[model samples]
Target: MTMNAALIRAILRIIGASLVSLVFVTIAVFFITAVLPGDVADALLGQAATPDAVAALRHSLNLDKPVLVRFVIWVNGLLHGDFGVSLISRRPVLAMASERLIHSLLLAGVTALFAVPVALVLGTASAIFRNTLFDRAVSLLTLCVVSVPEFLVATLAVFIFSVQLHLLPSLASISDIHSIGSFLASFSMPVTTLACVIVGQMSRMTRAVMIDALGSSWVEMAVLKGASPAHIILRHVIPNVIAPLFNVIALSLSYLLGGVVIVESVFHYPGIASLMVDSVAARDIPLVQICALIFCAAYLFLTTLADIVALLSSQRRHAA
Candidate 1:
């Protein structure tokens, strides 16, 4: 198929997949929340409420309705862009989630900014020096970083940088920063910690892809033609390596979005992951469901984008 036609088809498929994922997220949230031990009414009202007040609260929140009905209502509200209400703060769920989502996205964005280029450069360098001391050292470092738990990294960062050195604040507070420098200073530790984790995974993926790409026929031919190593890598190997790296990038993006819960909580960063944890702990069903749906949508969208890019790259290579 033509590239334009292929692109259109891919876009359609992505939209369809996103819709399906949304439905699945809704069902998953419904089932997960329904099976939890506490009564939603009691969880909201607490032990001080009388039995009659509890029943009244349940009725008000529509917890008295059938499970199916509750799910439908929630889904319908979501369709209308309402993410329900937060039980703890008595605020609109979307508003609360939006605030936290922005912080999380900012942190993730900054982390990626620091991670992607560093990983690519190191990976390429290691590939160029494969089986040598440099390659071994890079590989060992990647493995060590990947093996360490994120929580430990965060804790060590807080201890050394914040407590011992007094360079950055120990607590994750964004509110006190009135200037950009201060904001970045406050954000540096968490971003650096997250970036370490990202670099570990991405560098490994890049190195593997580079190694495979270096073995391809084009690379060998370029080398045989007396092309400089730099020319061969930049002109030949990098383009070929991109298709495989796209998948790795997509996976890392999804991981950053959904898997940062532990790190966020560890550092007390007010990101979506932390918000989701707090919401769950508070039994804020609406907030939890909304966050889950957003995360699922993001994952589906990024993965689909990667698939499309990989397909297009492969097609272009074939055409060439």
Candidate 2:
């Protein structure tokens, strides 16, 4: 097939898959949030509210509606970008989530800043020195990092950095973006904790993919041609591995997006995951649903972008 035709086919497939995933994601978020124990009315009313008042509030919120009807209404609003109001806060769910979403994006962005370069270097080095002490050491260290839970890692960081060294705050109070220094200071630990986990996983994936590519006969030919190590890596090695690395990066983006709840909770980072957790605990279904839907959308966006980039690169290679 021609390169353009192949690229178009890939794009069509991705779009179809994304649309199906969106439908299922919306249904799953709605129904799963619906099934959580305890009523929103009860949670909001507290011990002071009369049973009659609870019933009235539920009616006002249309909790009295049938499940299908409520789901339909929510889906309709979602289609139009109307995320509804929080049950507890009485504010637009998206409005509340938007602020937290920025914070999360910042955190994730900073994490990627530390993670990707460090991971690439380590992975490349491990591949270059395969089976030697350096490679074995990287394997063991990453395995240990992977084996431990994120919360444990965060806790250890707090003790060592906050308790023992008194260097940084355990809890992140990163509210103002204008104050870049303070924001970085407050968020340093959370970012570090996330980076540790992310680097390990990304580096391992890079190493695995690069190892196979390096072992291919073409790499031997490049070496026999008297290509400099840098020339061989840049001209031959990287282009070959870029497609698979894109897949790895897409997965890493998803993890950085929504998988930081443990780290956020530990450091008190005011991010989207933090908002989701609080909303869940407070039984605020609208906020929870909005937060979750945003995460789903973001994951889809990153994956689609990665796939497009990989396919375009593949097309260029085919054209060549």
Structure candidate 1, residue pairs in collision: none
- Expressed as tens digits, the lDDT of each residue in 62-109 for candidate 1 is 889898898888778877977788878889988888899998898888
Q: How close is candidate 1 to the true structure, as a TM-score?
A: 0.94
Q: C-alpha displacement of 122 in model 2, angstroms?
A: 0.3
lDDT of 2 at 6: 69
On lDDT, the leading prediction is 2
Candidate 2 TM-score, true structure as reference: 0.95
The lDDT values for all models are: 0.84, 0.88
Pairs in clash, predicted candidate 2: none
lDDT of 2 by residue, 217-284 (tens): 88999999999988877889999889888888788768887558888888888999999999999999
Stretches of candidate 2 exceeding 4 Å from the true structure: 1-3, 176-181
